[model samples]
Target: MLQFRLIVPADLTDEVAELITSTVGATHLTLLKGAALDPVGDLMTCDVAREAADPLLAGLRGLGLEERGLIAVDSVDMSLSRRSDDAERDAPGDGADAVLWDSMAELTEDESTLTVTYLAFLSVATMLAAYGVMLDSSILIVGAMAVGPEFGPLAGICTGLVIRRKQLVARSAKALVVGFLAAMLVTGAFAALLDLFGLFSRSQFERPHPATQFIWQPTADSFVVALLAGIAGVLSLTSAKSGALVGVAISVTTVPAAANAALALSYTAWHEVLGSAWQLALNLAGIVVAGLVTLLVQKWVWHRQRGRAAATSPPAP
Candidate 1:
């Protein structure tokens, strides 16, 4: 569950309260008449389940409460919530299910933007992937994927698409495209240097490297892997179970494909280079489709709960 602190104009108090109360996902709502600074306003504090947040928030916008006051939603650490015998028997683990619900509801592009650690990791990972693909080293490719930070923004892009957040979509796409391009260029330059010294060549790159061969052929299987990985990736984001993301790290060929393309360009093997480029596009598309669908389902479930709330609650007096 999440806690909301709502401040609204006095004139809209009745409608705002009615809106909050009418929200099926909200519970433990407490209303206040006035605070010193908000004498011309009203205040409301409430706890709401995740599945209920979307529609309730939408209703607030519909009621114009969105513009009337400060509406801030904060997380509740259920691990810190005091347990009681009053804990409902059906509640998901001391209301952690509610916590999970709210967190997912809170998922936004602004929320998913890369942080310092995120930037650092992604930079190193992309570099690693670029070099690995250039060398046609599968082991290095795998290692690069482990380091590449592309997944976060990729996930963000899909999140933006589902939520229709243009800012998020732009942010995510810029990060993905720019980040990969920069990494590839650097890695490609390095590969060119390696080839100039006869360390590797276009012929060498086209030669078999079992570990890096995945990029040579883009199959239906590759799309399936990316699609499944994308679904898992979003699940991790919504459930706040990021630990599961490590496995997702290895499941897609984005970094390797990127490295392959960069190295291919460096070696001037147009065919192998073009193939890897297609591989990158395929994987990115698969993830986006899967991610959009997953978020859509979550949105639908949240919307249905609000519909039920509207059915049960009467309008204000």
Candidate 2:
């Protein structure tokens, strides 16, 4: 459930109260008349089930409350009221399936920004993978995969595409591109440093590393894995099953492939560089495509659910 706090204009107090009362999954409305000093209106609060939040928020926005007043939403971890339970039961769909689009947009916007912390995480992950690749250590590779922050911008790009936000797409794309490029370059320089310390050698990298071969070998299965990961990633963000994101993080070889590409570049291994780059591109494309499709389907399903609810609802006299 979500809790909403609104400062409503004096004239719209009745309309706001009526809207909340009529909403199927909203309950516990509290109105304080003329309580907002700055806005000089009423202070109203209500609880709404997640499934009904989008439409309720849309209704409020349509009333010009956003421009004239203030709207704030927070998650409710626990609600002891029986009406809250009834509200959840009466809502059209499951709370876990609901997509709080406004919240998501804000989330992705923050995550997709190109920040120092983002770069630091990506670079560290890439360097770790560089060591893993040279040493042919699966443990280090997996650790690097978990540490990589590339998924944030990838998800941002997918969300932006589904919501038709061009600026979001641009920002996310820039973050993805610059983050990877910068990380790979840093990894390449780090690999050269390892060579200087006699810790890395061309022959060591050329040795058959059976466990880590998938990082450089682009097969159809690579794209398939990426597609599945993308679906899980988006589901994690939109739904309540966020823990699945760890599995999604480790399942893709994006960081490993980037590390391999950087290592191969340091050694002037054209074939390895090309193969790893192909693997990286294939995984990224698959994740983006799958995420886009998943979000579109979710949006469609929720729209239909709302339509069905509206059709069955009795007219308000």
Candidate 3:
């Protein structure tokens, strides 16, 4: 279940209360009139089924509460109220399957930003992948993939496309491109330093490593794997089942390819660099395409469900 704390203007208190009471999946409503000092409004709180949260939030936003007041939502890990159970049971769909769009937008908005932490993680992941490629260790490659933060920008781009938010698209694109470029450059320098210390060699990269050769080899399978991973990744994010993301992370070769490209550049291996770049581009394109399609399908399904719910609901007095 989702809990909402809303600060509403004094005049709109009755209207807001009526809306919540009429909502099928809302319960445990509480209101403290004139309790909001800063906003000078009433403090209202309620719990709603996850499936019903989106519409309820939309209704509240339509009332201008978001502009004049505050709307904060939190997940209820444990709700002891019988009304909460009833609310969940009466909701249109299962809670886990419901897509809380507002929540998703907020999540992706924060993740897509190019923060210093993001750059640090990406750089470290790329460097780890470079070592993994040199050693031809699948385990290290998977580890690097798990550590990479590329999926955030990918999801952000998909969300922007679905919502038609140009600013989000621009920001996500910039983050992805700049982040990858910066990571690759830093990993390349790291590779050169390792070579100077005799810890890495061009001969290692040129060796026939059957286990890790796939990182620099672009093929149809690369796109297919990335496409499948993209679907799973987006679903995990939308459903809030984050554990599934680890599997998605390891399924794609994005970080490994970028690492391979950087390593090859350090050794002046143009052919390997080109091949790895191709692999990176192919995987990225496939993921973004698949992610966009998955989100679009989800939006369509939810819209249809919302329509059916509205049809069955009784008219307001």
Candidate 4:
């Protein structure tokens, strides 16, 4: 369950309470007046189930009591009454099962804006990618893939499109494109500078490293890997199974392929560069398409379940 702290004038509190009380899924309701000294409204606390959060939030939006005897929904947090139950269920080694549609809905919590944390992670991943190529290290490439930040926005985009939220879709797509372009360009320049100094010989790009061969070759297996990984990635994000996310990242080859393209270009291996670039595009498109479709399917299933649950269960008291 989620808790809400709303502050409103004593006079307006009754009407506001009535509005929220009438809102479906509001399991508990209470009102307090002048309990808050803030210039804003007074404080009231209430709880609602997770499935009811969205509609409740929608109902609360209009209560912004900035003027007159105002009402404000100041904050919300999960209630601990059931914390032990959920925490035990989500313990490590147990796959975190989450509702995929609800998971997607959660991404809009902050309205899909890019955060500084994502930029820092992307920077580190880009550097690791360049270093991996320089040292001919598969492990580093995998690490970079696992650490890459683009997936959040990619997931956001898929989620937004499924929910028909254009603002979220636009923001997420911008983040994804800008992050990719910035990382690739920076890594490319670094790789070129390293090549010029003979820090890593250009010969490494040509000598067949079995690890990178996949970047230059496209096959049905590539699509299958991307499709399955995309599905797993979404599921892991929504559920408690985030540990599996690192493996999903490495499996997709997005960051690795981008790094390979930049490294190959630095060495002026035009053919290899083209192949790597194509591979990057193919992998990203595969992930996006598969993610969008998965979310859509999940949303449909969730609605059916919700309908069934509503039909079978009585309304909340």
Candidate 5:
């Protein structure tokens, strides 16, 4: 369930109350009139089932509450009330399966922002991956994948395409491109420094890396794995089941490919660099395509479910 605290204009109180009362999956409604000093309006609060939250939020936004007042939503980790159970039962769909587009948009919006933290994480992940490739350590490669923050911008791009948010699309694209380039450059310098210290060498990169050979090898399998991972990653994001992301992260070779490219560039291994670059490009393209398709499918399914629910609901008196 989700808890919503809304500040509503005085004149729209009645309409808002009526809307909540009539909403099927809304429960535990409370009102405090003239309680908002800043907004100078009534404070309304309610608990809504996750499945019903999107439409209810849309209705509230349509009333100009977002512009005139505030709408804050938080997840209820534990709602012991029977009314809350009934609300969830009465909702049209399961909470885990529901796609809250507004929430997703907000989440991706924040995650996709290009910041120093993002750059640092990407750079570190790539650097770790460089060591992983040199040492032929699968564990280190997986660790790098888990630490990489590339999925955020990829998800943002997918969400933007589905929601038709052009600014979001542009921002996410810039973040992904710039973040990867910056990470690769930094990792290359790190590899060069390691070489200078006699810790890393071109011979290490040239050695047979049976366990990690996929990083620089672009094939149909690479695209397929990335596509599958992308679908899982987007579902995890939209459904708020973030644990699934760890699996998705490890399944793709994005960080490893970037690291391999960087390491090869440091050694002036043009062939390996080109191959790793191709692998990276292929995986990214596959993930974006797959993520966009997954979101589109979810949006379509939810719209259909809403249509069915509306058809069965009784007409208001």
Candidate 6:
């Protein structure tokens, strides 16, 4: 269930109450007269099943409550009331499957921004993968993958495309492009510094890495894995199963590929650089393609389900 709190103009309180009363999966409505001193309005609150939250929120916004007042929604981790149970059972779909699009937009918007911390994480993750490449250590490579923050912009791009938010798409693209370029450049310089101390040598880089050779090798399997991971990653985001993101992170070689490319550039290995660049491009393309498809399907399915439910329901007297 989700909790909605709103400060409503005095004249709109009754309309808000009526809307909540009419909504099938809403319960626990409470109103405090003149409760908002700053907004100078009444306070109205309610609990809504996740499956029914989207329309109810849209209705509230359509009524201008959001502009004239304030609206806030929060997840209810635990609800002991029988009304809560009834609300969830009466809702059109399962809570776990619901997609709060406004919430998702806010989340992806914040995550996709080009922030200093984002750069730091990407650069550090790339540097870590460079070390992993030099030592041919699978564990280190996995750790670097898990640490990388590239997934945010990728997801942002997918969400933006589905929602038709061109500005979001542009912002996310900038972040992805600038973030990778900066990380690779920083990693290349770091590799050069390591070479000064004989830590990273051209011979070691040229040597076949039995444990990590695939990082620079583009193959059909790389695209397949990235596609699967992309589907899982978007599902994790929409379903609120965020722990699955760590698995998505470790399953792809995006960070390692960037690291390998950077290291090759530092050592002037033109052939290895091209291979690693291709590997990077293949994985990113696969993820974006898969993610876009997943989001489009979800949006269509949800709308169809709602349409079916509306059709079958009895008409208002």
lDDT scores in order: 0.70, 0.92, 0.90, 0.67, 0.92, 0.92
Comparing 1 and 4 on lDDT, the stronger one: 1
Poorest lDDT segment (10 consecutive residues) of candidate 3: 93-102
Off by over 4 Å in 6: 315-317
List residue ranges in candidate 4 displaced over 4 A.
Answer: 8-12, 15-28, 36-39, 62-120, 314-317
Q: Cα deviation in Å at residue 67, candidate 6? A: 2.8
Using TM-score as the yardstick, the better of models 1 and 3 is 3
Tens-place lDDT per residue, model 4, 143-199, is 998888677777888888877878778888777777777777888777777778877
Clashing pairs in 6: none
lDDT of 1: 0.70
List where candidate 2 sits over 4 angstroms from the true fold: 9-12, 33-41
- Predicted candidate 5 versus true structure: per-residue lDDT over 119-237, tens digit per residue: 99999999999999999999999999999999999999999999999999899999999999999999989988998999998888889999899888789999999999999999999
What is the lDDT, from 0 to 100, of the residue 188 in candidate 5? 88
TM-score of each: 0.75, 0.94, 0.96, 0.78, 0.96, 0.96
Per-residue lDDT tens digits for candidate 6, residues 19-79, read 9999989999999999999789999899999989988989999999988999899989999
RMSD for each of the candidates: 4.8, 1.8, 1.5, 5.4, 1.3, 1.4
The CA lDDT at 161 in model 3 is 89
| Model 1 weakest 10-residue run by lDDT | 84-93
